[model samples]
Target chain A: MSQKAHDIFFRSNAPVTVDEDKCIAHKGCTVCVEVCPMDLLAINPLTQKAYMQFDECWYCMPCETDCPTGAVKVEIPYLLR
Target chain B: MSLDNFLNLEQEYDIVVIGGGTAGPMAAIKAKERNPNLRILLLDKANVKRSGAISMGMDGLNNAVIPGHATPEQYTREITIANDGIVNQATVYAYAKHSFTTIEQLDRWGVKFEKDGTGDYAVKKVHHMGSYVLPMPEGHDIKKVLYRQLKRAKIAITNRIVSTRLLTDASGAVCGVLGFDCRSADFHIIKAKAVILCCGAAGRLGLPASGYLMGTYENPTNAGDGYAMAYHAGAELANLECFQINPLIKDYNGPACAYVTGPLGGYTANNKGNRFIECDYWSGQMMWEFYQELQGGNGPVFLKLDHLAEETIQTIEHILHSNERPSRGQFHANRNTDYRHKMVEMHISEIGFCSGHSASGVWVNERAETSVPGLYSAGDMAAVPHNYMLGAFTYGWFAGHSAADYVAGKEFSALDKEQIAREKQRVYAPLLREHGLPPAQVEYKLRRFVNDYLQPPKVTRKMELALERFDQIEEDIAQLKAANPHELMRAMEVAVIRDCAEMAARASLFRQESRWGLYHHRVDFPERDDANWFYHCHLKKDQSGRMVSHKREVEPYLIPLDDHERNAYDKLRLKAANG
Candidate 1:
């Protein structure tokens, strides 16, 4: 076998979740994405729906509270919980 | 590719305010009010509407010196005593004198404060001596109110820009700021006559004991950006050893809010559900008692509220859930704990630098002016000692007015292109790397070292070892890779965190005496040596670009305290019943 550089991925559950049915990101609404202080949420390019892009959520609830359609849910991060 | 090929944007302003959460907004508003003709720009790494420590809004003023309740001199005396007589009384007195005016201004701006039917402010007593804590049962909309005022003042707002370094001129005066948009990675160079740093605390310096990085008592966005920027800009940072450690909810890692619960008859109790401390005011002496109780086999404290009436608990629940970390309700519900039946578990928070809670920040005078000529600082990042949100607003008001007066006839110094060029390369390196270490892993390892080595009960050998590890992390910073602009922002924050960690270690090593309870408790130098260490221990970058620590005398008090008042905080621990 030849030695070469490669990448590995770690899997974890996202604390901030968005409901696909209620998400209005396709309509150009990025309320959840914009309101996040940590900038952890982003709109999925394929689905045009908002999703948690990172695991670093403060669980501050601004995303859920400021969501236009009540599409966002912030759970306590598993490690803290 | 050359730096010019990237999106390099430049703008000019009379004054630039960074970190738009609480103080930055007030700074911009007051600067505009001072001189409406002056162009002001306010920027934040996060959206200005929701940034900084009070992004979700605060529950109440922890140190409101209102008339008929407390005098300015009295409040100053109380703070001076609480901080073990090391505070600059003039700065605290300045905040106390202007505290009511700021409160009235907030009231006029449609923010509600709890007032009795007799038309008097309902002030509650939570401190050891004076009455402060004024509640805002409806303060969740404070950011909305501030955003409205910013728009009304016509202050130019730039959101999602993470400021990396302040640009200084040949005369060593701050002339501009260098930062990049977190979403686009576009470079920004804003020329300004004066710059006000209200960038909150170095809250993310220590990792939470639960091993969660973002689970911090202060907002995770405040990753010591202002402190790092000020230090690199040649500003004196006072009392780096005096760290901010609070009694917070375990695992969840947020304030149990003794100010709120204590007023409502909820108290901090040991495992046996008995009170051990007389006061819940978050002073060093109070935290000392809390640490003693936690360590003396009376471990794992709780906020006892089961004895309170159902209606009072309801009020507590409504207030705690509706404002400032509103998710507290969700965390509690998930754990199946209620204030009516179960006592909410409490634990001491990890250490960080915050003048608002204990006093470790950029040194500024009563006028909010830093040692640097064109730079001003306020809020948690500035060393005003026990300057909570209200002090943030009041000192912000002072910084705004002072910077306005400063820039009256001054011209923007030419932007230092060399500084801009160097910062641009430093910032973009992570994104441009082919393959390397992830920023999160690096941050995790770094913060774990912080907890291991620097979480008080400070040992000299451990801190020295921590410095060696910090130096190793500095090399690790160069290997960080960012897949996107957001990741790049965090990568840069890793660099800032490294700088703060090194500074914390050096400052802790420089101070030989244990003081401020567990904040600077060095086991090797266990006693408080007033004769030898009575002066403020300040740290700054020396001429050789080395971090150097020095001593500065504590300014004489404007309001002298009697011997009894001076030793008041020393008696916070309740004597045993048998004694």
Candidate 2:
């Protein structure tokens, strides 16, 4: 059929990461997610652990600085690095 | 992400502040202080705890008007000359007069400014005529202090609502705000007696040269939202042609921070490591020299810090890395560049419209009131020339007190139901579409066109073509598809960028003479024509809703500048350099 549709997926390494061992998102603490200015961090529904859902990070580091248990780290995006 | 349950969430407030950044918090706090009984709501698209340009805090006040260091009259004169004499002296004078009080207020609130052993504000000479740059070695916790104050003031804050439109009554006065939640996609119908917009600069208007969408000098969250919101509500914006193009790190897209390093003896140098300009204060004239050197074969400029002592370099690294954009240290480390041995490379930033640095914003008077009746604006979005952080705080205070007095006996105006429905349909069309262009892709194309055609050394023909392209991008905005509320936010921001682009083209074309150096350097109109173009170029939406441009006569100078002071910026080239 001429009605074929396609989507392109671009892969990017999230500059921000959450150390799951220290992350307390499973205990209902959402400080990191709540404080991010770019709103890039979110908790995975299945794992209940915080992760970077989108690669559009400003690397502003509120997620890292505001984490209660020191679970997050912000790296310079690879493109700028 | 349907709007079914979110349709009935209507709330009322005496005053609504639309950003939680630098000025918005101050506005909210001051309004609450003016009358503690008033119901004020402070909101941001992101959490207010970490939002705006100072989300991570700033290194220092770029323009601090302290008592022992400089006088208000002197500071006002410096800004008047630096901005090439199109300033409303009354507004700048008001900020200068109240600058120290604002500093004292922030100091009392636990935000510290650097002081000498004698406990005076350690102001340094960065401007050609005066000493205004006051450092804050421990300014990293400014947001924490403001947050504490916000809590103490008992102001209500709603996070994650991206305000897309200002709701005005039949009498054409701003009465409320319309927005949606970025997470739940809840449509917000916030009715207020007065609305204050503290959205930061139009940082995302020009796509960065690195081709990265979020790579910008001003925080990427400041996508010209306030300017768009104010313009759509029929506010006059001044100096839109005076684009904000800064000398930033080559690819990092953050400030190398001339204000911080310059006071400690670091200077901007060419390939030969020769200082061309006498001062490191950011002015259009200084940028003109930098541009000349770049185009005149000494192409790449560098922040010359290698010659400084190791202790000085460490102090710079401590302040530059610890505050504002700490990831800057990592960017330098990745490139193997260190202040101890290697000079950092620098480039001109993509163009933007920010009154904080270069004086292009929604027009406001001495009281921070816009041309509209119940609308006010401050921060980078307010048109106060060379007003940096201190200006934002001062003007935010003005907007708060003035707005409090304005709504003293005022009642809430009726909300226009038709306007709310139309804006709702406009915001949600992207989410309802099955297939369309992505918001990010459309933004990239629009901003790349901005860099190509609108970056200065502007030609009349090229600017005309930019206007035509911007018209096409408006049509493209209707075809944007957002799968969720986050993408919906980006889609709305793209519309703001398009409005700013059109304003840039129209404002630049309206002013027929070159002024503000690289900011509005029209190649076709290569000289400053004070005889014909001395007046301020004001732009607004006319009665028919077309973007119209006009001229506003410059007010008579209160502190009159002599001939020598007027030409001070023109003679910035150092005499000792290669002489």
TM-score of chain B of each: 0.99, 0.99
Lowest lDDT 10-residue stretch of candidate 1 chain B: B570-579
Query: In model 2, where do residues sit more than 4 Å from their true spots?
Result: A1-4, B1-6, B576-579
Model-by-model lDDT, in order? 0.92, 0.91
Every model's DockQ, to 2 decimals? Answer: 0.80, 0.81
Query: Which candidate wins on DockQ?
Result: 2
Model 1 lDDT tens row, A1-81 = 977466788999988888999999999999888889998898899999999998889999889999989999999999877
TM-score of chain B of 1: 0.99
Off by over 4 Å in 1: A1-4, B1-5, B577-579
Candidate 1 lDDT by residue in tens digits, B1-579? 445556999999999999898889999999999998999999999998888888888899999999999999999999999998889899999999999999999999988899999999999999999999899989899999999999999999999999999999999999999999998889998999999999999988999888888999989999999999999999999998999999999998898878898988999999989888899889887888888888888878999999999999999998899899999999999999988999999888988999988899999999999999999999999999999999999999999999999999898799877898899999999988878889999999999999999998999999999999999999999998888899999999999999999999999999999998889999999999999999999999988899999999999889989987789998888887114
Q: Report the C-alpha displacement of residue B427, candidate 1, in angstroms.
A: 0.9
Per-residue lDDT tens digits for candidate 2, residues A2-80, read 6834557678988989899999999998998898887888999898999998888888888888888999999888878
TM-score of each: 0.98, 0.98
Error of model 1, residue B149, in angstroms = 0.4
